[model samples]
Target: MSALLVQPLVGGHTGAAPAHTGLAAGHPGFLSPSGVEIVFVLVGLVTLGAALVTVTTRQLVHAALWLVVALGGIAVEYLLLTAEFIAWVQVLIYVGSVVVLILFGLMLTRAPIGRSPDADSGNRWIALVVSLAAAATLVTVVVDAFRATWIDLEERTGPGQGSSEVTGTALFRHWVLPFEALSVLLLAALVGAIVLSKRNSDAGSGSGSRPGSTDSVPARRNKAGES
Candidate 1:
């Protein structure tokens, strides 16, 4: 009887050991305290640098590529938290689909393939100021709110808990409405893009047609003038 009771307690404690070890591993590397902090700081700096470059790059394509880097960094951060499903979703949605669509639009619109003075506009300073102010405000708010909070880095597993399974179940069940709304939003955006592309094509066709190109001049006058 004593053995049975102690067995349950021992099992419970043993089950928790791996999770504690995993959390202590600190994201596949940086087993030490300073190393973990260094990794986190480096990831943040890279993410910020990529974002700044994405915004400030004059080349549209370069900016889009920079955006990919920034987004990939975010995905990495998600992965660090052991949220593989969310990280892959971020990569698929943002880096794969959205960026491809943006590049397609740029190509279809015949946007200057090379550097253009018009690409670098006059409002850069204003945009920079606003961005910096917003970032500062957010950082201040977050720092103040969490300054004294202690984060428990414990990896607790429940019954049959996997990120992909849980995320899919949650998305399809409780969050179905938001998921459907997003689908609708994507559909609307696709339709708007199609309409704009068609309009541009029609405008280009109209401009290419000269006034006399389709005119039926009097046949007799044409023959006489040609002779």
Candidate 2:
């Protein structure tokens, strides 16, 4: 659950504080543990529901709409972590741009507006197996990595904005390659989409040329009349 992730950053209820821990002891947070926990649970549920609907819905446009909700919930989660920049990126990139692009593609391809009976690929069994395997792998990795870890927020941040600085450094130093690769991947996908749209338009124009064949009949009739 998402609440489990909050444990390291916000501390659990049993006064588990190291001597140097700044947030776990006497220092008070803006929101109480129960309140934060409740909000996290609610947001998580909304996100999960949206994701499920997005995948399960047969309506293409409705799936995009639900995707927006799921992406918005992720942005909210980032905000709850006080990661403003990440939250804004999620809103601007994923929710706003990507979801819009998806809708545009669906419309451009002339997809059915209502339920598409053929949407299901009949690979539910294989997909379900793969999804469960992936989820179990991720859960195991996360639990093994962070089960006992604790972050003392105040100590980590302090008066110098150390937390953000460190995070920035780590992101740039370690994750830069992956970020750049992802950007390139997105650009390639965008280009492919454009190519596909052009091909579709060309096909449409070719089909329209069929009407021109009827124009020949008028010319032949005129010649016959003149003769």
Model 1 misplaced regions, further than 4 Å? 1-37, 150-153, 158-162, 199-227
For model 2, the superposed segments whose C-alpha errors exceed 4 Å read 1-34, 153-227
Q: Model 1 over residues 116-210: C-alpha lDDT tens digits?
A: 56776688788878988999999999976543322334567762233788888978998999999999998998999789769845654565565
lDDT of 2 by residue, 35-93 (tens): 55568679999999999998889998999999999999998887666666678788999
Residue 180 Cα positional deviation in candidate 1, in Å, after optimal superposition: 2.8
Clash number for each model: 0, 0
Q: How far is candidate 1 from the true structure (C-alpha RMSD, Å)?
A: 11.3
Compared to the true structure, candidate 2 yields what TM-score? 0.60
Name the candidate that leads on lDDT.
2
Overall local distance difference test of candidate 1: 0.70
